[model samples]
Target: MTPAQTTRRHVLVAIALVWALVCGGLGWATRSAIQLDSFEAREDQRRTDEVRMERALARMEAEIAPVLYPERARPYMHFRSYYIATEARYRSDSSDASRDILVASPLKDYRGPDWILLHFQVSETEGWSSPQLSSEARFALPAGGIPAPVRPREAAPENWFAALQERYTAPMLEQVLMETLIHSGEVEGLSAAGPRPDAAPDAESGVRTAAAESARRAERLLQMQREIHPASTCEPELVAMENLEAGSGQVLYNRETGACVQVYAPLMTPVWLDLTQDGEPMLALVRSASVETSKNCTLQGVLIDWPKLARELTEQVRDIFPEVRLKPLLPSEMAASATVRGRLHTIPAKLVAARSPPVETWGLSSGLIGGLAVAWGATLLALVAITYGATKYLTLAERRMQFVAAVTHELRTPLTSFQLYSDLLAEMPQESAEKRRHYAGILRAEAARLARLVENVLSYSRVEETAPNLRLAPTDPSNILEAAAAATAEPCQKAGKELVIENHCPRETRIETDSQFVVQILTNLVENACKYSADASDRRIWLSAAPGPGGSITFEVDDAGFGVAPKDRRAIFEPFRRGTSEQGRRAGGVGLGLSLSRYWAQSLGGVLQLKRSSRNGAHYSCFSLTLPSAPRQC
Candidate 1:
């Protein structure tokens, strides 16, 4: 390669290397940025998941507290009577606070010396016996004034305690306790107090109305009191002992005290006895369970389905992060380095998961990398294409400049000849007619050559601007050929070259074409054949017309000349391109003949082509023109 070509190659290589380095750096930077972003996102997700699990566990614990505590208290409530209740009474006379008395049962062992045996009255008038009596004899009742006679033995402290225990069964206590635990302190009243006496009425009817209204008001007050004091019983005189209904065991919370109060809905109200004749009634018996406090109650150690909880957490987290898996851990198993753990509110458990979930890298970044690569490739291709186009444009501009110089040279030669010949003719006297005629002929010939060159230039310009204006008509193919040959006859004779016209087409053959354009094409080809073969020994030019394939007409021009080189054949048809043949080298015409002929022939709906060229001895070249045949009717 030339030094200039070598320099260009090195420059292109350097640009390619620089572009490669830039792309490589960009790719590495993009990968690093993506990795850093992914790391940050993963850490954020871990923190977010930890917070989410903590909230979920808190909610779960809140939900599970009520269920677990109630379930834990169920068995205790069921067996509360057997474990908690005894025949016990507070000592009224004891100054020492520790001297409280518990009456012992005869069926069970009693080791306490401070414990006392006290009698319970069988009838209202019969009061409790002193602790000094024996346990069996202390329960004897008075002989007379008993409204309802009872067995004296049954009133003993041990027997009364046993009866009370049997009467308030385990199942009843259990129901009361369970209700109290669940509903807290809300309860319904068993009975209301009797109405108080209103003011004296003016009439008996008025007295009756006032009494009824007073009774209704008292009933409402009792309901209100029940609601206000859900954990307490009503006053005894106001409430009719027999009218009271059994309570429905339901629990409720006391908002003021934050206490779990159980309502032992009374199974039976107090029974009154008129044992004393003083017209006063005393309570015979009242059977009811005492209210129990649930402050120390607990429901810890309740079993929680940990696997199910983990699976549920996994499902919940998967909705937010599809690739994550949540594992359940005990409080003891939460120290693993790879695992992140959070406490569950519902149970004593922890949730564990990977800090970074499994994710497919290709799904996230392959498309990004591929897109970047494609964009880089497209940009590089565009840069290379732009460089090549600019180079080609510069080369064409140089060729155009050379063509301008050649055209100027050709124009000056013809102009100089015209000037010289015209000056000689103008100065010659009228007597020397032969010399004047000779000068005039030379001037005309030179002018004709100049006109042909100018016409070719103008025609090329028109073709370049748009299409040629073809005045198409139906015409005899023979007439067009004959006219072209006749026009070239004078030029051939002046140059001392023989011209031949052979018509192989029928005389009646007609074609549709612009006659002027056809003649121009024929003239250009004939002129080219003559000028390029001027140095040949034969000095012969032949023009022929014949029928062509596809209902077309053909015209051929042949000459024995130095043929165009194979490498330059296609180039010679370009505007401003001339043959590299020896004859073409010495020729004085601009290289517009073949180019214009081909353009005009195409405009007239035909073609002009170099049929063949010979490089051997007696070199020959032939050019052919083909025009579409007109319809027979046209």
Candidate 2:
């Protein structure tokens, strides 16, 4: 190899290595970027899931709060009376020594603690007597007086009062007192009052004066009650309550004065009223009706089912954050730093999500990236192929240019020889006939060489432009070989080379092919052998034909010459591709002979190929032409 060629090869190798490294580095960087993006995406998804879980937990807690603490609900129960006529009748019997009567009080329908009534004695002569204290003071009795009470036949009066005293203990009295202080107005007529207008000329003065007078009277009444019941430690305080006209129809009247009074206490148990003139305290009847408790103890009269509520909340969280898996944790197991906690009634639970978000590679879509990579690779390959094709095209073009220059030089030389020899023949007519004949022969040979060059160029151009037009006919292979050999026999003799034709084809064998094209194939191959082997020590050309496989015929042209180089053999059949050898370069023809011969053989529905060429032992080269056998005529 030449130094220039070796340097070029090394440069190409280095460039390929650099390009490969660059591609590998780019691929690795792309993979790392995708991994980083995916990690970030997972983190984002995790944060989002935590927030969603927190919201769900909060919603669940709100829903179940009331169910867990029912006392937080609003109050709905109010006081109403229930009658105890049986106890009233027993107390009214004349033989009874009990000072007070026992009756059921209002609030019987409530869920906790029973209620009762106690009627103690008070009197007009005993300073506890007043018109407000008497039940008959405001409303006159009906013609039949009051309704007769029902008596329980099995009951004993003595046992009943003793049992009542035991049940209404000190704690019960305190509870009733507290209830009176807290829910007095709420339970009875006091709650239905507002401020009243005064009848005096100065309204503000009249209100103050009336309030002072009412206080004095309440103080005097309280003192009288204390004197009458000296054994009791209960201290009753008076409170002023205004009356509003919009109140419901249950008015509490002061039996002593026979006037409406908003100042009253809740009647869960009984208190003494100074009703009779006899000095014995008359009973205030107390009865209890059913009171609603559950409605008052719950929010909006509805109880929440916490388990179902928790489940629904979990499902909602799952729907919103599909990638996160929620695991419920027990109250003890729940960490303070956990993502979120949920409660159902009093039960505590925590929401735990999966440790990682769903598996995915982030950044650009994988399919899009893959598609781009494939397209980029395909485009790169296409570019490389285009570059390689362009380089080959340029090389072939340079060779063709060289071939054209060589043909031109070859044509000029023969034309100059023809002109020179014709001038000599015309000028030396008086010379000997033999000398004139020699000049004529030189002109004819030069003309034949020029004609062969021109014919090869025209034929190659024609075959390249379009498919060759072949005149198919029946012809013997030997006849075609002999004709080509005869045409070159004289040229071989003058050039001091032997031309031999060995016909191995049967006498009856004929091929269907274009006869002129077959002869041209044989002539071109033989002529090339003669030209390339001109300087051989034993110069010889061999033309032979024989029967081939599949009822075909094979024609071969062999020469004792420097065989085609191994590297150039494949390319030798390409236009303008000549052997790179001293003998081949010194030979006198353009490089179209083999290429055109191959084209013509192909046009005849046959093939022309280098059958064998060896550099060893006289450097023999052989080219073969194979054609199909023709049908026999009847």
Candidate 3:
């Protein structure tokens, strides 16, 4: 190819490459922003979940303790809490999995702080659904807070048992199970596969083995109960609790079933005696069991941290029932549930936990992405100027401006298509009733405005250059006047004003001018009148066409608003010399609207002159256009 042709090809290639790079870079940037936003959103959700979980745990401790140990229970511990643990397992043939939990709470009316509860989903399926009971608690009990640690040993004397007649089995069961699970070797795989043979039991076993298993499971169950119900977060410790001494160890097997039910219900159970000394022995009894699985448990109303109670009991059972080498249930291995409520209705615990949902990050994500994108754009521009010699490279700025113009044209083309199709749809006679009522007439107005914008842009481009060809045709001046008046009427009504078309032209008169040009002239004149007359009490737009000396028409549009100054009169028709602020506010434009309209009339062999500007109610602008009469057919 020749040098000029080569140069042209090079410029085109550069432009194409730059455009592609920018587009792809922008797309990638957008995707990165979105993904980062998602990550941040997940983090926020996790934080929110943690917060809610903490609240729920706290609340449960408060409620359960009050019911189980009234003296220990405070006002906050009035409401009961059921402890739960949930574990999920995938079905063999499906991607989706189901979760099981122990000890679900049935108490639904969560009266808590607004910011913490109302908007969140509290359970596995969001609300209360498919909850597991891990361990049941009687009151809020911290790990190792119970009086007598369960261990293989001779039962406390008959007096100890006599004092513990009111003791219940549910809370003890939950604590035993929880402790066993937590100490299990296969705890890590709780969410996935079951425990290995070394860690868990094999199914087939003789009656003796089964009996042993049952006894072990029972002991473990009680351990889980203790784990579930623990002491409150803020209760003051009693010296008597620390002063109580551990008793001598001995194996006390339950002769009835050969199962060693290690009864840790000590008469001198220091944790209980310390409080009972000051007041009555507040019974922290387990009201129910809602355990679904080990890791997943829900104690309907736990007076203690059932899981922790379970753990403690597992140790206690091990110590007391030495001959039974039983394992504490790993959190994954045992499911136990129980409830604890005050004998009297309103004991409260200072610490309370609330269940709530995750937080949303849409606004944060969007703002972050937007800010980054704007920064990246600026940086990219700087890099381009520095590395690409943009200033010296083949009139880059000019080419860029041209590219913008072309791009705008491309954008406007689609908009034009939208306007046309939408307008047509709006005008469809067979449209649905709902659509007709909702969307009719909206598109046409939008299209007109868009068309006007396109005209203004093109007009500005041509301002310093020779204008485009103005094709003339013999047109009826009266028709052009009427169309302009009709167009202005819509705008006038919207502005709470009025428009009047005074057709004084003789029906016999017609002008031979470009019909488009005549329409343009009348539109401009009407617009000026409206702008200057909007605030006037007698706001009106009058259009009149009369036969002039030779076959021309004198068209006028008059308004009764704030008029223009004499010094600004001639300048208003000049390019960019718009009417002052008052006029501009009433009728906004880039100021080329009138100038272009006037130019179009002149180019079409017609005159467009402002008739008059007045301070009185008769403020108006008029234009007289002259053209040859339409040729008559023989």
Candidate 4:
């Protein structure tokens, strides 16, 4: 095959390869996009699961703890000494499998903000009792936002003591004690003011008697003019003071004295609290399993502030309960079953703190999905990058074609003129002096034109190929302008246009740049201006150089001609582009001159733009070039 055919096949193969690669890359990218989409769905599901769980937790908390505590049942418990007894039972019946009596745990060691001691009394023969050892307890709860109820009027001592005598004094005086000699040694001493048992006096017995009498006397003094004592004939009323509710350990107070002696405690003890099981359980003896008790008269005669105590307890509960589980409903069937089987006990304070779902958890799903999408997007971007680089290779091939075509035409035009003129001068003899001189001038003009064209094409090719690589040299400002003026004089004179040098810059103001490139720029611009003004009799070309800001020099070439239209200014500077060419006017060149000049200017870190124009004979197309100033000599 011929060299031309080989070159064409190579170009065709290269173009086909570029298209094939781009197509394959794009297909791969598309597949990746689909895979990412599928993964995104799974990510969305994961986020949805998380959100559902959070919402369910919020619902559970809302159901369990409402915004406000009920208005009617608020009460505070006051204990002199409170105790909680816990006994593990292998079987349900306490009697079927009995164990030794053990020490009870004190519910709270000392007085806390919620409670205070009121009165206490102990028994000589027994551990403690409320009646024979008369005691009173006080508590405060919300009563229409008031502290407590008004204190009742004190009852007569005789009436209160008489009632206490019938309750306790009758129970202790047993049949054996009334008919036989039931001494203190056999029956122990009775409660003070009840039956006083007669027994022999010994060192140990004397100390016990003195201690019991001291406590009894103290109780009697405090209740001298109060309501019925602990062992009053109104014994039923006394038992009522110890009543308790089933769950929350809240108290009930006496309306008359604003005294709380009864409270609620957990009344059921399970071997294991079944979390999966819903609703209350069915079982016997559960009621008596969690019996609440008061320790000594320490529990009686106590005062409490319910609201303040509730606040403090809330803080304590928050501190103690730190972990929260996802609500069971939010998980998938398998996941939820697993969570339910897992160890779930206490919930975090935040779950129960508010009545609605927290706003912070709102975007839980979107955030997770977004993170996954970002990772997938990174992979997709790599595929797109490969496609972009391959496509750019095709564009480069097209620019190469344009370059070859433009360069060939540029060489051919001037070469043809120079060859024709040189042949005429060579054949003419010295005898035909004036004709020979004319031919010599034509030869010189054509040769110079060829030289300038070659220089422009070569310099512009270099500038375009390696942009920002400017070949700079410091020289006189006039050097470039003088060379351009000399080359363009013939064209200007032919067109009857005056080319003027308006030098505002100092003669010594030098610049660093490729002289050939500068001369080419001025030559093309001045030649274009002259040709465009060929119809005008009084045509003028203004070449000016001035000192610009930042120690730079600006060179401008202006021509009085049919100036460019506003819309065509930007479009005219592109390769193979021309302004709106008019009929009956000198045709513009192939339109590479301005485009090449722009490339040259930019390679030197400068710009070329149309400054201004006019409709009159002084119509101007300005070409300004700027470059860095050289350092001054010492």
> Which regions of candidate 3 deviate over 4 angstroms?
1-444, 463-467, 613-634
- Runs off by more than 4 Å, candidate 4: 1-395, 411-444, 464-483, 505-518, 531-538, 550-552, 562-609, 613-620, 631-634
- Which tens-of-lDDT digit does each residue in 254-289 have in candidate 3? 233222222222110101111222232221222112
Write one digit per residue (lDDT tens) for candidate 4, span 395-472.
Answer: 455445655765576668677867877787788776988997887777777677677666656655665466544456
Q: Each candidate's lDDT (Cα)? A: 0.53, 0.51, 0.44, 0.46
Q: Count clashing residue pairs in model 2.
A: 15
RMSD (Cα, Å) of candidate 4?
20.4
**Total backbone collisions for each predicted model:** 16, 15, 135, 11
What are the TM-scores, per candidate, against the unseen true structure? 0.46, 0.50, 0.30, 0.40
Model 4 worst lDDT run, 10 consecutive residues = 281-290
Model 2: how large is the Cα RMSD against the reference? Answer: 20.2
TM-score of 1: 0.46
Question: Best by TM-score, which number?
Answer: 2
Using lDDT as the measure, what is the rank order of every candidate, best first? 1, 2, 4, 3
Superposed Cα deviation of residue 431, candidate 4 (Å): 10
Where does candidate 2 stray beyond 4 Å?
A: 1-354, 357-366, 381-385, 426-429, 613-620, 631-634
Better of 1 and 2 by lDDT: 1
